[model samples]
Structures are given as structure tokens and as C-alpha cells.
Target chain A: MNNIILKVENISKQYRLGLVGTGTISHDLNRWWHRVRGKEDPFLKVGAVNDRSAATKENYVWALRDINFEVQQGEVLGIIGKNGAGKSTLLKILSKVTSPTTGEIKTKGRIASLLEVGTGFHPELTGKENIYLNGAILGMTKAEIKQKEQEIVEFSGCQMYIDTPVKRYSSGMRVRLAFAVAAFLEPDILVVDEVLAVGDAEFQKKAIGKMKDISRGDGRTVLFVSHDMGAIQSLCDRLIVLKNGYVDFSGDIPGGINHYLKISELGSSMNYANVATDFGIEKVTFLDKDRQEVNSVMVGQKLVIRVDYKNFDKRNLSLSIGFLDNFSNFKFACRSDVLDVTYKDNIGVAYMTIDKWPLSEGSYHYNLAVHESSVMLQNIKEAGSFRVEKGDFYGTGKLPGKRGSFYIEYQWE
Target chain B: MNTKHKDEWLYTISSKRKLIDFNFKEIWRYKDLLFLFVKRDIVTVYKQTVLGPLWYLIQPLFTSVIFTLVFNNLGNIGTGGVPPFLFNLAGITAWNYFKECLTKTSSTFTTNKGIFGKVYFPRVVMPLSITISNLLKFGIQLGIFLGFYCFYFFQGTEANMNQHMLLFPVYVLMMALLGLGLGMIISALTTKYRDLSILVGFAVQLLMYLSAVPYPISEAREKFPSKVALIVEYNPLTQITEGFRYMFLDTGTFTWFGFFYTLIISIALFLIGLVIFNRTEKSFIDTV
Candidate 1:
């Protein structure tokens, strides 16, 4: 069994919402007074859990609440969450860039966090100089950096401009150099937060490959935070999902991903209050052939996507609907003009039905657009979402399990 | 939290605060980073400027000229028997180094917030690097002053060169510590209050006059009333400038007791500043 190298016990971070200067002094005094009397901090009990969607009169909010986990040596741990879910706050605490309002962390060996690329790179410094500066900031010694200088430059692919100032490099070239320098950091544990989101696709692929080498080949612990579910699923052995500053789920990749998808789908129900626009989609719903609202349908079920819009202009409008997989990749699309369907009413309902839907067992999103010829009047991305469950399309007792996104009929001799 | 396996663990982070928890060993381990930061400060300042390093020479030279005219010619302040140009040059040379270190280090939190927010290392490394980089500039400016001192010496003018000159390094170290200590305190405070950021420049400017940079301490004692002269004599910088001129120019007073007094003060201030700095560094990112 692998050794547990990092342990986080009930870490929590609270932040005041307003100007910190004048407001913090009183809190500091309160803390000091409490310490003098040998009592617990008075303000720690007052803050509410972090939820950006809700309104509150309190000034304090908990950015992270009781986050606890352990990472074994050579284990790759992935953290996933929606925006404002306290993912960055947790990483910052583990990195020691900021202190938690409460709790402790115990780790074996050094931990290097690549929260952002080009963190300390000076624009006026040459590429060679920035490599040294950024490497040192990441906890590499001068001798260590000198030993790996050639490898870093070669990996960055900026060998020709090694002596040129970083200000002269393009944004892509800078990110490439930054990632290369960070990739060479040989720590016992590496904490990375969305730094792989920069650079071109090729460089991102190379960076992900390097991270794999860092954990598997070098046998080091890695804590990674990213919203790219595909990357997380492929890279992480275990996953942690955060919601409203709390750990929603922590387990295997597939289970955690499914739980996150279900939660987000439940949160984004067809509420017209959030989809108010001048001439756009007022609400979107997924229904079966019987016109009953549904969120999960069988693979061969007749799925109907209904879009209600208030078309302020009474002109004939064409509606285009697209189906996308869980990764937001377009799987298929249908346009009203292709089927000779038009809407002439000021307030209209457009529905597209796919008889015997061919999608496999997975979650998906649908996009809606209302247009007149080439001019787009309204467009809503990922307007509605649904899940396709396992079902037999061939009338046999067989159903597709963990296969690809869609299915097709075939006959073999 | 158990100490039984504490030896096995390599790193531990907690909410425990200590008053004088200065990690000297950790700082020694990161000496390479300190040197790299010092190098960056020196190399990048004049990278694209046309004057390059000559700007270092021009600033003090012009400031000394202005001091010579305004204080010597207009204000009738005497430089004992030494040439007024050399007197003002030496004062500006030593003062410039301290002022630069203080101003730069005082803004450490604000200027390096981006880097500090992203990574973790010894926060003290930033201010320590500023002191060292400014020390290099001080060395250059001291050479220029020596050049002028030699000319006046060879011309049979009263240029003091004595055995007291052996203590020059100690004097420079004291000045560096004083600047670094005050700068750290200001840097830590500004992360919360931010009013100190605006007051530091104006305060340093006013402090220069009280430090006897443009005139000798004796001149102020004789010209001003006793109560006013007592305030000038109390400033720690007065002893430094007076002792510095006493050694090189042989014109100002020098006392061993006063030198030790300033040394003790510098060390105390440095320790206190380090305590405050360590306390602030853990959470300054949030407030800043």
C-alpha cells in the first residue's frame, strides 16, 4: 500500500466581503481580546457558508468549510467544481500562499504549487533570466536550475529567443516557456490549478503528459484542480467535487462526475426567471413523446426539446437546435428551415422531436437559436440539458454500457 | 498534531503563531533564491534605458551639486575645512543607499503581491535582496566619492583619511539594517492600513534633514538653540553621518559609545520588524 503523504484536517477559510483595511482592525482587536482571555475566536462562528447565488446581510462568508482529505504518495487527486465553489481558495490554503481561518495540514516532503504560469517573470528580463527567477520562486535551488536549464529551454521550444526579453515573446510563447519551467520543478508533491488551460492545444497535451510523468514516473503526489472533466477523468485516480464550499462527493472519477452533472442539471431547471431577454428564449424543457417533462430518457425514447420565445418582431423566424455531449462537443444539430418549419407569431413555441434517439448512456446539452435568414435574433448556449439512459435499440435484451456517445445499426454476414 | 512522528514528517502547516519564530535555517536553505532576486533587481532596472548604469552616477552627482549650492553657497553652511563638494557628495552617497533600500522594501507587499499570491517561499527574501542590491549601488557611489576625496587630498587640502576608516564596513552594515528594519515594518503595516504607503516618502524626506546629511552635527549644534540641537543629536542617523565624515574627511565628531548605541538600536529594530513581518506574511495575501 502507498503511504499517505499529505493530510488536510478540517480546513476552513473565511473572508470579509468589504474593504478589509478599516473593517479588519476591529476584527483583529476582537481576536486579540479573545486570545488574551484564552477564549475561542468570536468571529469564526458568525459567517455563513459560501453561496454566491443567495443574498445575505452578514459581512463574513466561508470560502471553504471543513475541507478534509488525504493524498497518498504517487496518487493523483482531482478537484472539480463550478465557478465560485471555493476550489481556488482550497488550493491557496494548501499552497501556503494564505492561511486558513482554521485547521492544519501535515505533509511529507516539499510541496510546490503552480497556481499560475509566469508567476514572477519580469517582462524586462530575458527568457534565460526569467527561467531562473521563476524556478527559484517555485523552490528550486540555483544549482538545480542550472543542471536542467537545457532541458527546460528545449521543452519550451523557444531556444532561438532564449536571450530575448520575455516582453518580446508572443502570449503563446510566454505561456509555453512558463509551463516548461514549471514542468521541470522536481518536488515531492505538486499542486496545480488550471495552469494547463493556457497555451495552445499541442502545448496543453505536452503539459498533461509531463504531469503524468511527474506523478507516475517520478512517484510523487499530485493535487490537481480543473473544470475540464475529460482531463480530470483521464488523469486522476480519485476525484473530489465541491459545491457551495462543501465537499459534495469524493470517490472514483466516473461516480463523482455523474454526481456533479446531476447536481448542475437539478440547479438549472427550466426557470424562466433566469432566462429573461428582449427577444430570446424565455424557457427550455425536455419532454417525452407524450409532452410530459422529463430529465432522463431511454436511449431509444422519443425526445422532444421545446423552446418558448417572445419574438418581439412578427417576422417569420427559423429555429436551429443542436445536441452536444457532456464535454460541450457538438454531436448533431437540426434546423427548422431544413424541415420547412417557420414561426410567425409574436410569442411562439418551437419543438424538435427525434424519434428513437440514437445517443448512448450519457448526459448532454442542447443549444437553441432563433434567426431570420442570416441575422441571428437570439441565441442561447446549452439552454437545456438531459440524460440518455441504457436501452435496447435492436429490440434485443442488450443495452450499451460505457461505450461511445452514440449508437448505429449494423448487419454482418 | 502529535510530536511522536514529528521527526518523520518533512513539512507541517498550522494556525499556530509564535512571537519570534524566525526561520533562520530555512532562509539559509533558500540563499540561492535571495541571490537570484538580488541579481534580478540589479540587472532589470536599467535594461532598456539609454544611460544604463551611468544613471546611477548622474543622480547623486546632480543631487550633490544642488546641495552644494543650496546649503553651502545660499545657506552659508560650512563644511569645516573640507571642500563643500566632497562633503555633500559623501553625505548623498551614504544617504542615497539607505533611502533607496527603505523605499523599495517598504513597498514589498504591494509590488510583489502577484508573485506572493501565486507561490510560497521565505517572504524575508524580497527585502533582503533589496538591501543587497542597493549595497552594490552604494559601493559604486562610494568609489566616486573616493575619487573626489583623492583629488582634494593630493591638492594639499584638508581631506581626512585616518585609521577610523577601518570601520567603514560596520557603518554600512548598520545603515543597511536600519533601513531594512524600518522598511519591513512599513511594508507589513501597509498591507492593512495602506496609509503608511503614502506617508513613507514624505517622512523619509523630512528625516534626511534631521540626520545631518547636508551639514555636520556640530554646525547645527552651534547655529541652532540647545533644545533644537538635542533633537538632531538624538536621531540614530546623526551618529552615522557624523562618524562617517569624521573618518573620511576628519572634520566631524566620532564617539565609540554612540556607535554601539546605534548598533544596538539597529539590531532591536530588526528583530521587532522580523516578528511583525512573520505575523503578517501568513495572512497578508488575504488583506492585501
Candidate 2:
């Protein structure tokens, strides 16, 4: 039997930019007129969901556009996107918090959404009372709430303060209680929207583990949204990459991650040249093995970054490059400041290059700093990044973790 | 995994209406939430008030005092031989229930929009819970009204508080239905313009004046023998308020014509309110 629980087809949600109310009265009237005439909503037809950053003639933009997907019973679908990529809007539609402007969605079973923790918690109510209140809000019966009350309290670890009002409880305590109620209630369709962003690292880890147990152990469909790619890769069986409100990629987890990383890297480079204006440097390039400018270079190749500076004062000029790992950790820094070189020539021009990048098969960023060894002049943190594509030169080597910044070949015989 | 079992489950409850309309069964299953909502409203309403629950009685007591002073002393408003305090107290008790229910029910959507947006239950359960919770306040006020009734009766005062007072509960029920109906309509409307919200206070005040709260229907009836008295008596709340005064004080006249008129209007408004409220709950988040 086909166990399709949710089927969404060409779902699109259009939102007028800016204030939602009286500010859009005239536009609303025009929309009403177009609606009455049985024409396409004039605003929706011309606006593209993917053109959020691009200048448009109309003020309306589709927060979500042409989204299509189906979730089978007991499938955990991860939604990953950058800020303002319409992940929340899509989840809101799926959870029925809002409706789609166009297209239809057919869903089975009741949906329970933890759009935000403590969503319905009355601050004046006691912790125990709020658990029952929140449970009821999540559609649990009184008997069900009573039975789970102890478990919920135990999970929240706020048993001593059970009688205290939630307003007095700390934010972490509030989140724990809220998440406890939502998780314990066990709705058939659970829609979690970046709720893991709350609490300390330990609590986030526990919450993620709890979510994994909920999806894996229970036969409930889950839609998890987060900007944390590691969490998405770990918990989601399938991933959907949203770019400007449209599904840029949707498939198995690894492929989706690859596409998402590529899109994000391209986005960083699109504004790369604009970012180099502060420095008196005219050009910055990522050079590969054969001395060619490329964004992605093969692993274990001669990765050289050439920078051209404008001043002839080598005494006052210094160039530095920093290597950032895949998770955006700064692995190490190489600087010309360490070298005792001075440029006191008549012509004000100099070039410096790094040989043999020594990084593995993953993404790395290099930043350039041009100034006196003692006085800092210009520092571009994220100057540029290039992907180290998998290569056969070192054969297929395993990294320390399941996936990390780079794959370093170690001779451990 | 079994196709036969899947088909059987599908065929058993495949009616289109069951899918389109809200499943009241699911709401009934969530009766705990309904009870919690009611409990929250009741417990939190008088949390920080000076007298807490005693504030419920202060309204009718104060209103009774003012009525006894102004109407009996200054305006010479007759109470048909009933003590002005008892007459006014009974009217105020019944009027308080109507007014509270109307105000509470109407603000259900606006007041609870935060909760409503987060969760899904029978949205009707919210207004229903408000209508139920406001009863606690009304119940306390009614007890105070009854205390005065008993005191005056024992004092050999001719307030006429007797066996016919059993019908008081019926009057209370009608007032509740009337308030719920009107409140639901306004609650649904407030989600859009919010203009109705500001007017609700004035509307409640005006409704109190139109109802025979400080004055007995009998005196109004005697003054305007023909048309105006007929119209005043025909007012649904007026009849219900006057019915309470008639049952206890025996001052106002009661008729099946006026009672049935109120009964029909109350039920009609309630049903209309329910239909509109249900529709509004589904999409009010958009406007709200």
C-alpha cells in the first residue's frame, strides 16, 4: 500500500513586501478587482520567488513558489536554507498556520507544529498548569495529558519549580518544558521549525537526539527546518534545499548537501569582488595546478592565491592568508608579516603567491591582509573559497569524521 | 502493509463531509484542552484583584446601592411594593451574566489569537469555554443576590421572594445563550476591522440602559400603555431581566409571547454565530 501522508503540488505563497495592513489598502483593492474578474492574481503572475535580491517592478514577491513534494508516512524530511529562503513560510503552509496563495495540498492525519517553543504558554500559569494547557493546545485529551504529566515534568527537569509560574522560569527551563509537552503529546505529523536553535549546546544536542528518536522510533512523519547543516545531515533521511523560496534541490541527503554548499559558495563569490574594495589591492585570484584562476581545484594540487598590491612601501606593507576549514574553522594562518621583506622601490607594485595549499578534499577560505607588519591596514575575512574536488591521485581516503572540512591522507602503516 | 486493511479503513469513513467540515470528534477528544482553557480563564481572571473572588459580588452590590439611592430616593421610580434594593439586585445579577458572557465571548478570538494560531482544536471550544467560565463569576454574583433576597424575606419585607423563583435558572440560561450568540458574532467580526472591539464597551453600556435594569418593566408598562412599553417588553434581554425581577419581586409582568420571542431570537443568533464563527476560525489568522 502506498503510505503517502502529505502531497503538495505547485504550492506558492505570495506576500507583499513591507507592512501587512492599512499600508496596502490600494494594492488590496487592485488584487480584489483582479480576483473578481477571474484573472490570475496580477501580482503573483509576474513576481518570481527566486528573484528576491533582484530589483523588480512590482512590490509583491512569492515567499514560496512552485514547491512540490510528497512525504510518506514515517518519513523525516529536512528543510535546509539560508536566512530568508522561505523555509519558515513553507513549514507554515504545511502546518496549516497559513494557506498557499496558489495550488493545493492534501494531507492526512492531524498536524502538530512546534513553530516556536512556548507558543501558547501563558506566562502567569504554573509550570504544571502550563504543561496541561500546552498539551491541550496540541490536541491531547485531558486523560492523555494527565497520564503524560509526570513524564513531561521529568523530561523538563523542572519538577521542583512545577508550581511556579512560567514567567518566573528561566528561558532554558521554559523551552525544556515547552519542548517536553510537544514531544510527549505525539502528534501524527510533527513540524519542527528551527526550534533547536534555543537552549545551550548540551540542550540542543539532547533536543536533536529526542527529535531523532521521535522520527526513527515512532511512525510519525516529520518536517524539520534548520540552518545548521550538520543537524540536518544527521537527522533528516531526505533533504530539501530551498533557495529564494523554491526547491533548488531535493533528493538524498548527501546530494542535497553538495548542491546546497555549491549554491552557497557561488553566492559568496558573487559578492567577492565587491568585498575587496576596502583594500588598495586591485586583484585577488585562486590559482589551481596549471596556474589558472578557478573556484574549485583538485585536492593535493598547487593551490596558489595571487594578490597584487598598489604601494611601493614594502616597509609598511604586509600580506597574510588564512585557511578556514569546511565548518568555517580557521585551521591556520600564513603571513608575509613573519618574513622580513621590505618594498622601498620607486614603482608601487608587488605580487605574492602561496604554493602547495596542503589542504584536503573539501572547501577552504583564504583572507588577505595588506598593511605594515606592526599596523593593520586592510583585512578581508572571507576573501574567497575554492572546493577541493575528489581526486584519484591519493586514491579514495577517509576523513576523521563522516564529513568534515578536508580529507587529509595519513600514512599509518 | 495490507491492501485489504487499508481499503477497509478507507471505505469505512470516506464521506466527503467528514473530511471538509471540522471533525468535532477530534475536538471532543481534546476536551482536556477545552477544560484547561476554561480553567485558565477562571483562575487568572481575578488573580490580582483586591478581593479576588469577592470582586464578583461587588458589581451587583454597588449597582444595587446606587439604584436604591438614585431611583428610589431621587427619581421616585416605583418597585411595585418590592424593596428597591431587592428589585435592583435581581436585575443587576441577571444583567451581569449577560454582559460578562457577551464581553468574554466576543473577545475570544482577539484575546486568544496567540494560542489559536499555535494550536488546532475545535475553535468553538474557546468561546464555549469562555461562556462556561464566565458562569463562575455570574454564579458568585447570583449567590450574593440570593443572600440579599433571603435577608429581605426574613425581615418580613414584601420582596415576594418565593417558590416561583425556581424559574430563575431558566432565565439565566436564556441570558447566556443571548450573550454567546451576540458575542460570537462580534468576536468573529473583530478579527478583521477591530473597530467593533472599541465599540463593545459602549454597546454593553447602551445594552444595559435599554434593558430594564434600574427600572421595573411594570412601571414602564404603566407609563406607556400602548406602543413604547410593548417595544421595551419585546427587547429579548429586557424580558429576561424583567423575568428575573417578576419571579422574585413579582413586580414585572411575564408573558409566553415575550419569553418565546427571546427564546427564538437567542437560538437563531447562537446558530448563526456558530456557523459564522466556525468559518472565521479557519482563516481568521490571515486577517488577524
Candidate 3:
């Protein structure tokens, strides 16, 4: 018997951005006519991988372009991509929620998708009734559902309100019930998309555990998408990175995570106009000890984030430096110059330092700003962003001893 | 033993067909879901209404009474010897079923888009389930007609009802096919235009009058000789409804040619509707 359960070839999905009606009708009609005639859709011929970062003239752009991959039975594949990278579009095509503008997806057995928590849940129906309804919608038969019904209820921990309408349940309870039904579906292929992000911490751990059990114990193929790098790294045996609707990288999880982090940090085009107005920060510059502009710096090396500006109108200004990780979750923030610094004249330069930059060996972003006495300065939000290079924060190729953005070295007796 | 069986099962599952194209066996396996939807529609529709299921019977019965008065008594339309009440009731009942099926099926995508967008069931199942549940409602109304007929028969007041009434199932099926076909075409189109949805309610009413639900074709034939009556006679729904009266009431006409003509037309239209509907379901979400 063949072990390959799913084959996705050159699959791409394209979506028109504005009001769906009237605007795209002619384009849709032409596309449909071409499809019926068995010709390559004309729209796919335009656009390149580099076209993603900059907006282009073509009305139609591929959301997922020429994506070719296959998943054998029992493979747990993780998909990670920043916003607008077409990760959700890829899952939507594979799960058959929507058809691709071009390319083909071939899969054996039923495919169940948990695209969003409580996606098919009817608020008016009881939890139990919704289970049956949603289970059926996911392509499970009544007998198959009955066999796993008890296990689902127990797993969700919503047995007390199983007969209660889902509308009355709390948000956490709703996601639990939804996840329970989705994960227990036992389809030949399961496609999950950021569904666990809504639940509580305890439920999230349990959900990941159940996903592992599904892939390992049942030998079902799984495709998962999430922004949580740690979860993706732990759960997926293999990973696929989507950057602007194209498969940028597809391989082992560690390498995919590294590539994803780098792209996110480098992708944004910094705006200088918005940066100068905030935090008494008239100007922000990256410099070495020699006060020269430096484009790149090694990890753990002496670095400076210089904010030069005015103490206008005799107000107290506090300068703060914060570090953010690839997922945009803040790793650490600290404020210096807490004491009242009064300057009758308008200009001065304030420097902040990271002696050891304990950040894990990955690209990190630092935001430098001055708050008006504790409140962040105006325009500070727009003006601050700088990259930190990989240092020997945890030795070479080793995970930060702790599962967090940066390792904070502390002493014990 | 468990390991061996599990291994075999896993192998078989992976080896199953990919790119499933509307398998009937898979649909049959999800029969419970179909029943639940059928039950949900039946129960929820009348949940807060005062008259409840009585609305079903009262609607056609009252409409039939109105027709009998305006078309038969006032306008002097003939019933071919059957009482005007029974004559109008038969046509109105059958026509109502077809119209309801068409209306419900046409609005299938718009009404269930919320549900369909969230889940993956055979898209056809929803419209098919709606057609069947409506047939159940039709069955109840048909029962009311039978009661009226038995009352008139035992009382010896009504004229002869034709024995061809035994061919009732054929007419019922024809009505279903016509409704499904027309409904599917409208449903597929509505996903794109949506203007059709707003006009459908009134259109069904206007179509009722056009189908000769209130007056018999025999009477129309006497008044307007060849051309006008010929058009009404050939109306696909005309043959089915008039065929019902022809079978049960022993009245004006029953032509094998008319029945065959309608059966052929309805079947062809239904096949076309299915093809268009199948293609539309694939990409309707993008537009909708």
C-alpha cells in the first residue's frame, strides 16, 4: 500500500482586494471561461516573488503561488508565515474550503479543518447538538462520531454544559468544545490554522499534546499554521515558510524558524519621518563606541541606540530601551534617566547600552524612545526600530537554556 | 491482533480514492446529518408562530377558495363537471408544491452561505435535503385533498375522478424535477447577481396565476381556440398539474404525449441545472 496520503502540486490562490461585487465580475468571468477551455489562467502569468514587498499595478496577484509539496501519512507539517504571506490561503485550498485559482490538490480520505475556533458552531444549538452538526460538516458519519463522542466531551472538560447552548458558554469553553470535536475527528488529513491561539494556557498545552498524539498514535497526516514559533518548532516534524504567497523555505523546523525570523526583521521599510517626533527624540541613530554609523553588529558586542533631541517646555523626559522578538512579542523593556533632567536649552544626546545582549542567537529588534515623565513621547511609536545580530548568547546552535525570547543570566547561591 | 487489524485499516485508508467526485456511498454514510437538517427545518420554522403547521394547510385551502370564487363562479370558468372547490384545490395543491420547491431551492446558497462557508459537506446535500423536507410538507397537504375527495365521494355530490389518478407518482416526480432544475439554475445565478433573490417571492406568486391553478385548461380551450390555449397546454407545469386532475377527477383531458413531453423537458433542464450547479459550487465562495 502507498504511504503518500496527500499530494499538492503547484497550488496557488489569488484574491482581489476591495469590494467583491461588480469590481471583479469581468475578471472572474474571463477566468472561468479560460478554466472551462482548459487553458492556463492568464492572471498567474504576471508577478514575481520580489513583488510581494512593494505594491504593484496588476489587479490580480497570487496569494499562494506555485506551491508544490506532499505530506505522507503520519507527517506533522507546520506552516509559518507573517501576515499577508498566504499561509491561511494555502490551508484553505488544501482543506477544500475554497478552490485554487490554479494548480491541483490530491488527497486520499477525508480532510477536516479547524480554521478558526467554533467555525461551524451554531450559537443557538447545545454543545452536544453542535458536536453532531459540526462533526457531520467535517465529513464524519454518525456512527464514527458516536464512537468518539465520550472521549471528545472528556477532553474538552465541558461535560457539565454539554447539553447547554454554546451561546451561553464563555469564550474559553467555546474554543475547548470546538477543539475537542476538531482534533477527535480522526480524518485521514487534518488541517489546523491558529485555532489554539484563543484558548487558555492549560488548554493550549493539552491541545498541542493531543495534536502530537494524533500524528504519532493514529498515523494521520497533519498540516498546522501558527505565528507562535515555539509551538511550531515543538509540534511540527517538518516546516514550510510562506513569504508573500510563495514557499520560501521547506525543510526541518529549526532552519525554517531561523529563516522566518530573519525575513520578518528585514521585511519592514522603516519610516524616518515618524521617528523624530517622539520621546523628545529629534533624531535616532545606531553608532559604535566611535560614534560612527554602523549597519550591522555581532551578537553580545558593545552596541548603542542613540536618541538625540530637545527637552522642550521644561518637562521631565525618561529614555527607555526595549527589545522585541521575531513574533513581535516584547522580550524586555527598561527605562534609564529616571531622575529629573532639566535643560533650558533645546538639544542633547542620550545613549543606552546592552552590555551582553543575552538575546538568543537570532535577529532581534530594539526600540529606543524617551517618555515625557513616564508616558512614551509623541511619535515614539512610529520612530523606533533597529536590528541586533546573532551573538554567542547560548553558545553556537544551542536553544536559549529557557524557552523564551532572551536568556536573563542571574546568580544563585 | 489489534496491531494487525490497525495496520491493515491504516493501509486501506491511505489507499482510498483521492479527488472524490460526489460519491453516493459517502453521502449515504452521512444520512444522519441529512435527517437532522430535515428535522431542524421542520421544527424551527413554526417555533414562534401562532398557527404553526396549520399555516401549511390553510394557505393552499384559502387560496383555492379564492380562486374558485373569482375564476369559476364570478368569471364563469368551467370545472369539466367536477365542483369548482375540488377542481381548483387539486391544481393549487400541486402547483404550490412546485412553487415552494423552486423558491426554497433557488435561495439555497444565499440562505445557507453562512453555514456552507464554515463547513465542508457535499454542497448538493443542503439543496437536496430542502427538496425532500418540502416534499414531506406536500405529503401532508395531499392528505388534506384526499380527505376532501373521500367526503365528496361518500356523500355522492362530486363527479367521477379518473382512474388515471393511479399515475399520480409520475406527476409528483415531474413536479420535483422541474422545481429542482429551475431552483438549481436560479440558485447558481443568484450567487453572482443576487438581484434575482429580491424578485423571487413575487415571481412565484405571478407564476401561480400563469399555471392555471385557479382555472382548468379545458375551459380556457373553449374560450380561446387554438394559439392561446396551445401555449398553456404546453407549459411544462401545465401538463403535470392538469395531468393530476386528468388522473384523479376523471376530467377534461389526459394526453400521453403531453406527459412524455414534460418528462423529457423537465429531465433535460434538470441535467443542465445539475451541471451548472456542480461547477458553480466550486468557486461560488469567492464571489459570494
Clashes of each: 0, 1, 9
lDDT pick, better of 1 and 2: 1
In model 3 chain A, which range of ten residues has the least summed lDDT? Answer: A267-276
- True-vs-predicted CA distance for residue A200, candidate 3, Å: 4.2
Q: Give the candidates in order of lDDT, highest first.
A: 1, 2, 3
TM-score for chain B of all predictions: 0.96, 0.89, 0.88
Please write out the lDDT profile of model 1 over residues A1-413, one tens digit for every residue: 54778898898999997677666778889899998999998888898778888888888999999989988889999998888999999988888999888888988868899887887889999999999989998989999999999999999999999999999999889989998898899988899999877788888888889989998999888999998887897789999999989999999987788778877734354322235466766777778899998868788778787878776476878888878877888998889878888777778787878888898876777777878877887777876666678887777877656757787777879
lDDT of 1: 0.86
User: Best-fitting candidate, measured by lDDT?
Assistant: 1
The root-mean-square deviation over C-alpha atoms between each candidate and the true structure, in angstroms, is 4.1, 4.0, 5.1
lDDT of 1 by residue, B125-201 (tens): 99999999998889889988888888888999978678998998999998999899999999999998889999999
lDDT of 2 by residue, B181-207 (tens): 999999998887788999999989987
**C-alpha root-mean-square deviation, candidate 3:** 5.1
Clashing pairs for model 1 are none
**Ranking of all predicted structures according to TM-score, beginning with the best and ending with the worst:** 1, 2, 3
Model 2, span A370-391: residue lDDT tens: 6675777777776766566764
